[model samples]
Target: MTIAGAQIVHEKLEAAVKLLEVHNVDTWLILTREGYDPSLPFVIDIETQDTTAILINKSGSHQAIVSKEDYETFKQTEVFSDVITYDTYMDEVFLKVFHILNPKKLALNISLYDHLYDGLSLGLYHWLERLIGSNKLREIEVTSEPILKQLRCVKSKAEIEVVKKAISHTTDIFEEVFGKMEIGMTEKEIGQLFVDRMKMRGVTNGLGKPYDLPLVCIVRCGLAHRNPGDHIVVPGDIVIIDFSLRCKGYVSDIARTCYFLKEGEFEPPEDVQKAFDAVVDAITQSIEALRPGKKGYEVDAVGRACIEAHGYPTIKHSVGHQVGRATHDGGTILGPRKTPPRPQVEGLIQSGEIYAIEPTIIQDCGLPCILVEENVLVTDEGPEVLSKRQLDLITTPYKGVK
Candidate 1:
């Protein structure tokens, strides 16, 4: 492992120890083989070809048991105090570690809510049950969701830097594509412009397929989430581009609205401008509500209130979601507080967490909906906006002859 990689592992392990204590877990066990656990990267930053057993204790000690071929790699990470190797069967060594630790409560990578915390496959889980004996496994096994919720949600200094770079690159691509857009260009063509730029930069789409991204929605006919199609940009059309990109395992998501000016027009129509302003106001209020200790639904309500105050219906989706390794890196969800509120929405906002706050306004009169998204970093002092805010609608001239 590189020096930086080792440092990240060290930092994560330190945090994991505290989390284990917080959850009252005596130890956390991660088991993997050819298909490694999804959470493995955050722990060791490497994959093992053979079955591997990683144990982390609340007492701030960690150890790894891997095949002989993978032993040296685990040692180089320097995060584990002991790197034990096995020739073939790891049953002996794995059980011996459990015997030595004798943890009363053991957490496993199983979750009812977050898929990121549910990395252990059914087969592997059964294998563990047999290895540890059914009675003992049931007595100790608990979900690692609580620990993982914070571990993945809270951004380290290095993770934040990578996300910022992704945001920067995404915004730059948006600028170039919007500038080159001409009336009569199909939505697919406009979407391809972004794909082409991403290729030049050697980055991949953060959330969806390459050709399907930047979800180009031309007003009057286009809808959100649907892949860009053959709808042509026309004069007087309002366009929405929802774009995201990934860099070094981190991702960014952002959306912007643009207006194609008709002949003799220098700005958007009055109604279009009103809708844009309302969406921006909604996003602003949501950001202001992003403070540590606030629940996800509270922040969502602030933005929904803004939309309603401006005479628009509540948006169908959440106001925002945590963004990180995955586009919708799971944790807290800034969404509605329903009768049976989801556990995710009840989660408290914390410092060092990055969120993609998008408040949308869909029009009933066939006008294009307005969606403006911004990436925010929650800090102790206040919310810091990471992406450049789209304060006003992007206006472009119609090149087609009248």
Candidate 2:
């Protein structure tokens, strides 16, 4: 039997209620409407329709308030015990729901300070105030930023399985591209090749959710992750490809760096191999330290220190981040130089969470980096890698052979 993450979400909600109890907040409210010019899609796309509002109390009793049309579908999710359907307007229902619960404090998802938690729009906020009908629920404060962040950081077993499936497909596509590499191929051509191949392998239609399948699937040579030119692949040019997938909400990010081999030169240079190993070593060390009780910034520093010790260029980005519905899944870094100390690292490594640790270390000038990234499940014992052995550099044995 498959373990649905509905249990995990409910468990987290219970923990959140406890957290609110400590703060003396009585009720938590999560309002969802069709977003306006969304910067990014919501992770909980399946939970609600165009309009939905969830009311959870300290008693652990809750209702998923949605339109009448979606009541049947909403009931199927089983996340909420009662599915309350409304007719035309939400004003009367909204007020009555709050009045009965009469929470001392109602936690809403309105965080102006943190961009990640700031999902409520200005228009929707105005609408919410309209429902207030001249009363200020400022006392009903907007909390749950921390709860939302922590909940998403931790991936459950069900989440891990879905991520694992997406990553395996990614692995197959990456391998196929290596076998089908062409010397004179443009970055556009090679990048699209994987996208085309994914279709053939039943990645989207087979998997369900139709993500653009990594809008920026990049294949670059020479200077990678920079202004990667449309240069023709030449011998000694290190080709690097960064790919991602938003599979049924969970996202996977993986990058592979391959060297252009001549008739004689076969494997990657010894120094380059060392650089690649260092990238893996950094990932290995970071994954070992992951658990339910570590600091986020502190974890990032560990990865940074490892990369720098090898005399590699410190990645401009963090060591690793949260992976859920979005690619750069959550805020906070495992890199040494994260600005804000997101102390949620240890909590993030809790059981049922999924994360990707991809460290890109530039070997030398004009040389491509050994970009190594793979998804892992944070288990009670340790982390499990979803994407398998991508350690050694994959080189094109012979050009125009496939």
Candidate 3:
């Protein structure tokens, strides 16, 4: 790891230690083989070939046991107090360390609600049970979901910096592509502009393959999150680009809507403009409600009400989700409250968390859908809009055919 990367890992390690103390977790254990655990990258940037155990104690002691081949890799980091290397099996060494730590509450990566914390595979869980014996495993085992939630949801200073850079790069590409867009360009061609820009900057799509990175919808026949096709943009066509890019292991997700004005027209049709206005209002209201100490559903309701009040159908998806290491970083979800409120929606919004607020407005008639997503940082005062807000619909004038 470079100096900066190593510094980030150290910062995360320090934060993880504090989270363990806050949650009353005596010891936290992560078991991985062939890079299975999602939390591995955040904690340590190394991938292990064989079964590896990462142990962090509330007492500020950290240790790791890896295969002989991977010993030097872990040791070189100088983060772990003790890096033990074994020849054949790690069960014996892991048990030895378990006995030494003798933690009263041992937290493991297991959760039903959050996939990011559900990194411990069934096979690995069984292996741990067998190795430590079922009775003792049950006596000390606890889910690491609470600690993982804060660890992932709350961003460090370095993490925020990386995400900011990612968002800046993503928005810049959007501006460049939208500025050069024309009436005759196919959805695929427009999507290519983003790809070209990403390549030039040495960045990548946040979620999937580059070709499938941005969802380029012509808005009439296209669906959300679907790949761009050969559908050509014509006069009066509304285009929605949902794009995200990965930077330095972090991600940024933003969406923009554009209109191809017909000849002599300066603005989009009445229906499109109305839908866009409603979307902007929803986003604005949602951000106002995105403050610390608020529940996810509370913030979501603000945006949902704004859209419905404007005579639009209820949004299909949640108003927003926490964005971080992943696109949907798997923490609090700004969604509607249910009979028994879902754990994710009931999660309280805290400072230091970044959210992508995207509320969709599908028009009543044949008008195209309006989706405006913005990234924000929750603070004590309110949310600070990280991305440039799309207050008005972007317009590309139609140049008559040659």
Q: What lDDT tens digits, residue by residue, belong to model 1 across residues 1-402?
A: 655556667778889999999899999998887646878877887768888889999998798989999988888887888999888798898889889999999999998766799988888899889998999999988988888778899988877888999999999998998789998888899989999999999899987665455788886875668878888878988888888898776789999999999988988899899999999999999999999999999999999999989988888899999998888999999999998879989989999999999989986768658988999999999999999999999999866643
- List candidate 1 stretches off by more than 4 Å: 1-4, 209-212
> Which residue pairs in candidate 3 collide?
none
* lDDT for residue 383 in candidate 2, whole number 0-100: 72
Model 3 over residues 150-226: C-alpha lDDT tens digits?
A: 88999988888889999999999999998889988888899889989999998999978754548898877656677
RMSD of each: 1.8, 4.2, 1.4
Residue 320 of model 3: what lDDT?
99
User: Would you give me the overall lDDT of model 3?
Assistant: 0.89
Off by over 4 Å in 2: 1-25, 35-50, 133-136, 204-230, 338-349, 400-402
Give the range of the ten consecutive residues with the poorest summed lDDT in model 2: 36-45
The model with the greater lDDT, 1 or 3, is: 3
Q: Give candidate 3's error at residue 34 in angstroms.
A: 1.2
Candidate number with the higher TM-score (2 or 3): 3
Quantify all predictions' global Cα lDDT against the true fold. 0.88, 0.65, 0.89
Writing each residue's lDDT as its tens digit, candidate 2 over 110-186 gives: 67556667766666667877777436766466666766665555555565667787787888888888887777766
Predict model 2's lDDT versus the native: 0.65
**Model 1's lDDT to the true fold?**
0.88
Q: Estimate each model's TM-score.
A: 0.95, 0.83, 0.97
Better candidate by lDDT, 1 or 2: 1
